[model samples]
Target: MFKLFLLTSLLFLLPIFHCYSLPEPCSGTCVNAHDPSIVIRPNGTYFRFSTGGKIAIHTAPDLRGPWTYKGAALPNGSKINLKGNQDLWAPDVSLVDNLYHLFYSVSTFGSQASAIGLARSPSMDAGTWTDLGAAGISSDATKRYNAIDPNLIYVNGTYHMSFGSFWDGIFQVEMNSPPTTAKSNVQPTQIVHNSAESAMEGPALFRYGEYYYLFFSKGQCCGLDRSRPAAGKEYRIMVCRSGVSTGGFVDKSGRACTNGGGTVVLESHGWVYGPGGQGVFQDPVHGPVVYYHYVDTRVGYADGQKRFGWNKLDFTTGWPAV
Candidate 1:
């Protein structure tokens, strides 16, 4: 019965081998992807939504893509009736109840007169979205938070959103429904901020094991040609973790996230420069993966093109390592 025992052992080990295999990184000409949010379809097709050019859409059959451009998600522009609302930035997508919900930022660069607009599609495809107008706005002169870089996550049966850029780091509000809108009664809580610099944005939240992790990009972004920061100081990814979903986030050294405290998650290495605008997704095969855009210094920053970057996350030591 040795052959029978050998066959049984092989079958048991097959699934374990498949689960631990690392995913192939995105390859080929990956360009013009900024502030990207990636989602996988039921059939395992990859759909990546990004900032600028009216929220551009790109698709690939696998992670290591022969990625194809699929045109703009919002061709006619936002229905918010703002002057510079056409150029959408930082679109976050999630599928709920058979509907694909897209939340994007509408504003002029460096202006606080901004709103986060909502759009939906039955299928997460380009040119199929219907804009649902303003989900939230930050038009008041006294308000410090800018309504941009929207990231939505479901925590403990409640829908919560963490959004804001530059002025006040990241803020969180409980959503009344999935994908769009927030509860009117609960005010937005300032969850993470950096006091050392006025540069903080692109807040992405992911829950791993018993703690919730907050990932955000800090330092100057864009205009690399005119004024690039010190070699290693340009846009970089930082992270903090909290036991509760809403507040009390701190870095590995026990420094509060609201007080300029963040542990560097990923930064520039060699040709990769200014890596930021990050989002985390759980791959069915490869566990947790971090997706973001980084400028290729080899191509020169003046070219104004950003490429997609992703790495599998390891939490074996109790904190995420790429």
Candidate 2:
């Protein structure tokens, strides 16, 4: 009887040990360092960029951090900040032609005024940042639309960016300059449009096998109580796959993403509400991990304060199954 009681107690305590063994006081080291942009350098270092108007460097000999923060990857206050600027939002980083290019969003939050700018860093080390200047700007709120969430991808010797916020859904632009050059004629084209079910934003693009996967977040972000059952709204990470980079993106149901084809890749369960601003990276060892943020619906937390989290990515059937 005594041995059986001990075993039973151990079983109950096992769950507590497992849960508590994870990290605590979720911060930059956790995940979703705001709007995370992750990249791996040739030397096997992983760097992350966030939307706090600053880029953070996470260096590890391995894919996983026990990852350390070096500092901002770009010079402070490099934005033009012309009309109703809201610091920096989502940043996309990539290396091309032996140089590093950082594309980021400058927008006015609730307002439509927004722009996408470019910066360069010779190396991933701290303080090697340089201001390359604005790559493109929207003409006005309506026609020009909100220019945000910039992601760069090189395909067949052509540099392409997936970006947009309000008005049209996610937009794509081609870079005329070499992947390294910050100055380019980014001609905007509508690739994805909004739907009635949700408003889509924060697009991250990646290609695996023969399919081009566009990973995006939809619905309200921030607000800790936003995902409460009675809240009547949800923020989720959704995905669509296409044969072409420009995309005829469709969901598992074969519905176009322009018509709300986004199938939930990650979502709020319990108190974990994700207005998924995310980045996908090919880890040298772990394969690929989706780094993103979510609202920790855990009790006794302040409003608008969300926690960051990361999970090993699973790609089955050409979709990013997180």
Candidate 3:
């Protein structure tokens, strides 16, 4: 009948209309979450590690709900004694050998006087993490790389940390077993570099099927006051993929990522502004999920006012969809 046809037509059109509206996050306080990284406990508790306030810890029973702000992971701060030791950034956490190992960044903004440090906890409970000093990688002002935004990835029976910011783009280095430190005598290799040679950081590497998806942020990341960057120059989630862990990453367009080519995974749309600093995890309920910090234009754009956002990734098309 005409009535039945009208109902079906509206149903198909709804997704096109609502696709830009991101799902709301957390039932309680999800504010102050910048550079968000998610780790789920075996018992289904979600722990959020983010940059700021000594790597602040927030937890929830489920990803959607009644989140509670737990205390700092390191109340006393990092043991590395760097300039930004008290205010950690870009925490990448993973559970290995029954212990939760966290790799965090210690650096001041715009300076390569930065170091990545390691810490671990038997349980991801707040105040339980013990700093294990630097993870054996650093960069000074004279270096080509800024050495921040650390993401821990395991591939082919070895561990590698992908990190970089501003100056050069993204790089990866091998780590020995236990992965407490970077392997000595091994030089870091450049994995993904934008051709423009600027403003790419926060690499979260993951293996989905045959390719290693290199998800990173591109363009201006902070200070979106008054005016924003011109269109694609604002902070957006970009991705490249490689068959192997080390290099040869290309975008969906078959363009080399190192040649300033990357597929935009998510960008400013509707109320969601400058969504980057992303991390991914395979969730039991949601499957593959990408979590990030986004400036909700409705809320304001200060770093502290940033919000945690997540979406289940659809890889049906051989590339991730938010």
Q: Score each candidate by Cα lDDT.
A: 0.83, 0.67, 0.87
TM agreement with the true structure for every prediction: 0.89, 0.82, 0.92
Candidate 1 residues 99-154, lDDT tens each? 98899988877888888889999987887999999886454446778888888888
Cα error, candidate 3, residue 97 (Å):
0.9
What lDDT does model 3 reach? 0.87
Q: Identify the superior model by lDDT, candidate 2 or candidate 3.
A: 3
Give the 10-residue window scoring lowest on summed lDDT in candidate 1: 15-24
Candidate 1 regions exceeding 4 Å error are 1-24
Q: CA lDDT of 24 in candidate 3?
A: 47
Ranking by lDDT: 3, 1, 2
lDDT of 2 by residue, 33-111 (tens): 6777777777766677777636556665554456666777664755556553335667788886677787776666566
Give the candidate order by descending TM-score. 3, 1, 2
Model 3 lDDT per residue over 1-322, tens place: 9999999989987845325448546677788888988888988898988988888998888888678889899888888977999988999999989999989999987788999999999999987899998999999977778778988887778998889997877888999899999998898888777766488999999898998999999987887865678876889898999999888999999998778878988888888889999998888887888888888888798888988888889899999988
